[model samples]
Target: MKRNKFWLLGTLILTVTFILSACGNQNSSNSSNKQVLTVATSAEMATLSTTKYSDTTSLEALQNTFEGLYRFNSQNKPVLAGASKVSISSNKKVYTFTLRKNARWSNGDPVTAKDYVFAWRKMVDPTAASPNSQRFESIKNGVAIASGKMASTKLGIKALGTYKLQITLESPISYFSELMTGAPFYPQDEKIVKKYGNQYGTTAKKTVFNGPFVVTNWNGTNLKWNYVKNKKYWDKKAIKLQKVNVQVIKDASTAANLYKTNKLDYAMLTTDYIKQYQKTSGFHSKTIPLIGYMSFNTHRKTTANIHFRKAIAMAFNKESLVKNVLHTGSTLNGIVPKNFAYNTTTGDDYRKDAGNMLTYNLKEAKKQWAEARKELGKRKISIELLTSDTTDSKQIGEYLQSQLETNLPGLSVSLRSIPLKSRLAATTDYDFDIVYGTWQPDYADPVNFISDGGQYHLDDDYNNRNFRNLLNEAATKYATNPTKRWSTLIKAEKQLIKTDAFTAPVYQGGTAYLLKNKVKGLQLSPYGTVLFYRNVSIK
Candidate 1:
């Protein structure tokens, strides 16, 4: 699933209103005596429904409130959570999972294998309209079911009695175990879902949780929520924090003030504030495998031209954008981020193997623009660039507007900044010439980025048969051959970015944040939920 950063500037007032309206003062507990952690988030969660939610904030919320068969630990390694045991068939296609007998939801109902079957089937059902339906294509009959060629009941997942679950895959996935840690694979209670129907995950009361925490006070659109410890959790003893108070604070200065006032246990720093807090205590930063880029609508008139796309791609100065504007990201030369997805045989990073495909050259951009203008038989071209109304996104959109208009002679770029939700809707409808986008991998694999990033969904009219074939071959024909698969994936990336210029690669994401000294055992991961609060404790 595609994850967009939802930091909207105008929502700050709404966030404050919701926080103030929250019942009582949850943060009033004595910090020294109570295991309560107060944190500030940059964005509000879209929804709690695992089958529908797409943004990172909602994924993180779901990760904390729901237990899957496996969960990523502090080391970013898969660890057992709901399932007590797992067995695989000799053919490596069938997996049998045994649910923990003690595992029960907040309602005291034993979480059975039926929950897994229900959730899996719902996600892949064509009528469900899940944006992440393609993620389950590896499951047996998954593609047919998602495409409406087969009934959802035919999906290769079965509940073998009350405690055991069986899953059949069409082909072997190297990262199958790691993939189980994602929220899409988590179980959902059939009874509760049927009862609530469309309103199931819209509010805190409508959802049931079996993970380390149970969400509270979230009324679908609220900016403030609480994560109270689930007493019925199987491993409740391991959960140290009794409650977690989360509030959305998009402004970096507001977050900094909250952090200094001891109201926030964790806060993310923007570029302007990073320098001020660099020498302060509890300051940390890490480079995550997040690729930020721009997606061009190939169906649009001027953007449809390959030369026009190439001109726009080479016009932007990513180095200056990352260093001078966004201080917490690294400029990218390829679709894959550096230090991610290494070759097993040679131990070479995929980025180094792929080499540089994106570069900033005003001379080349001008040349391409001339060709594009000649081919289109137009002297002037106007395009609208759609972006989220976040501070970072606005800065990026402004920079690109200035650079594109200045470098490309006959081009006029207009900026359209909207809320994250509105921007996503417009992008899905292909309502803009170009749009700013970001993609974080679902797991530690190159295919996750290459396939999900833009290959299948970027532009409605952008279809390169060769690029698609290479990816399909890597996933199927070379499934077990790591070396061949790695080589094929590299070729596919080059085809998409260099040869086709379907999308422009921006910079890799780096996160800088402040955590209180009292907060310990917080796990920061590159994939899935970046912050794992399962092991977090308040000193």
Candidate 2:
């Protein structure tokens, strides 16, 4: 009886052991099935519709699901996608493209020429209210129609067939190709747009992917997300990763912790942490296309005078700010930096032409302030500075407040910090004395810096004060002449600096994220747009 009992016990133990081994194998297989790159980005999406996008966070999310007619290469120059050939007419008025029939959306729908036509028209349509419509003015009549002078259909884009598209333009634009590879021109399927009317792209499930990944279970505020591979994507073989997960974290310290714990694959270092982490393992940094500056409310009674603007611009010791507030990159003297921001005509660089004394000109600034005080009644004026709650923003605001007061005796400045969205609204409404503003270029072009709402000519052109009507008029001349445009842009930038009208502040550059060594194929250009994340992978 004892021997039989022992034999039964041994048989039961072996059976249980086999079952547990099978479960372990199953879990490993599931994990190995997909390679996911987890990204930590704030989950603020502007809008699902590519045209109406205003927020950077949301646009980055949408870029994963939709396919543009042209997509940016690692260098940010446009490359043909669904299109087989893209060419401009000799006169530069006609742009033609032949589509590749092999392209398919994630839902197995054909990506056709009509899709491109519909998307382009939808963007510039006055009713479309697309923020990016201004980016496409080089397309035939695109400028006039977008300005509301011409009819929506009058804008120069049309589909000749299921796979061919031609864009007519009033003039030539140097950065047109770069614009094509980005958002405002991305094609939307008529079938999908029609199926989900106003609700389309409002949720994660309503959209389809023609790019490398599909966003699943996305919420506007999720610190986490998934970017699943699109098997139907035209270049699926080049996409090795099966998924990408995005996690939002506001604190750089927390981000570092995540990277250390193996919870994050990549992380950005704040100025406070840059020095400490540069000595630790896995540290990296690079420059990006962001420009951070303080926009003084020229509309304010006390601040309205141009001298006040010049004084404020002069107060910024860019070199000191870079050393104290920003530790990661070089201090840029001009608003636009070198190796970036070009002129269309001679391709004269805005940064190179910008005279180099990156250091502050106290004497020049002081004289401007004196002139400003004489223009105004007050030897002393109390002004307010506004900022957001981020660690970087608050510090910058506090620093500015201190600098202005210390440098200029008559300047009494107060500081206030609010949420980012509210601060943006305040700046737009001219609600404060001075507010910090940042601009990320829509496309790589000289017009990007000088144009309003992405277009050059508007009766009210709210984005710019139309600082130089001469420059604006000159830009119009270059509307067809690229060389002439470059010279005019240079002249405008020079005049802008000479007057101390505005400071570019900090040329926020690329981020050197500490990415997990195993991660691969996550590509970015020096001037990267967050919206082009289709081909990124983990392995």
Mind giving the per-residue lDDT tens digits that candidate 2 earns over 1-539? Answer: 00000000010000000000011111234334345455665323424677645545555666666667677676656787768898888977688888878888889999998888888887777666555666665677776676678887776778888788888765666666776766677888889888988767766677776787787876543445677878888888766666566655545667667667666665666656665677767776666655555555545666656677767776767767767765655665555555667654456666676555324667877887888888786688888887655566666678778888989888898888765445544544557777654445656665555443111112232234345554555535667666666667666655554443544354344454565655545555335435345554333
What number of backbone clashes does candidate 2 have, counting pairs of residues 3 or more apart or in separate chains?
Answer: 16
| Model 2 stretches with alpha carbons more than 4 Å out | 1-33, 74-77, 106-109, 126-129, 190-201, 221-223, 341-349, 356-359, 370-380, 410-416, 419-422, 425-432, 452-483, 495-504, 508-510, 529-535
Off by over 4 Å in 1: 1-32, 261-263, 454-456, 459-462
lDDT of 1 by residue, 1-539 (tens): 22222211111111110111112333534444466666566566777888876666677788899988898877878888799899999878899999999999898888999999999999988778776676787789986787789999999999998999999988788789888888889999888999999999999999999999999999987878899999999999787778877877666678777667666666666666676777877787777777777877777778889899889889988888887876776888677888878887888888888899878878988889999999999999999988766666677788889989988877898999886556666765668788885666777778777656633243224458887788778867887788999989989988888887887887787777777666689876655225677887665
Which one wins on TM-score? 1
Counting only residues 3 or more apart in sequence or on different chains, how many pairs clash (N, Cα, C under 3 Å) in candidate 1? 0
Model 2 residue 127 distance off true place after TM-score fit, in angstroms: 4.8
Q: Give each model a TM-score.
A: 0.91, 0.82
Q: How large is the C-alpha RMSD of every model relative to the true structure?
A: 4.0, 13.0
Clashing pairs in 1: none
lDDT of 1: 0.76
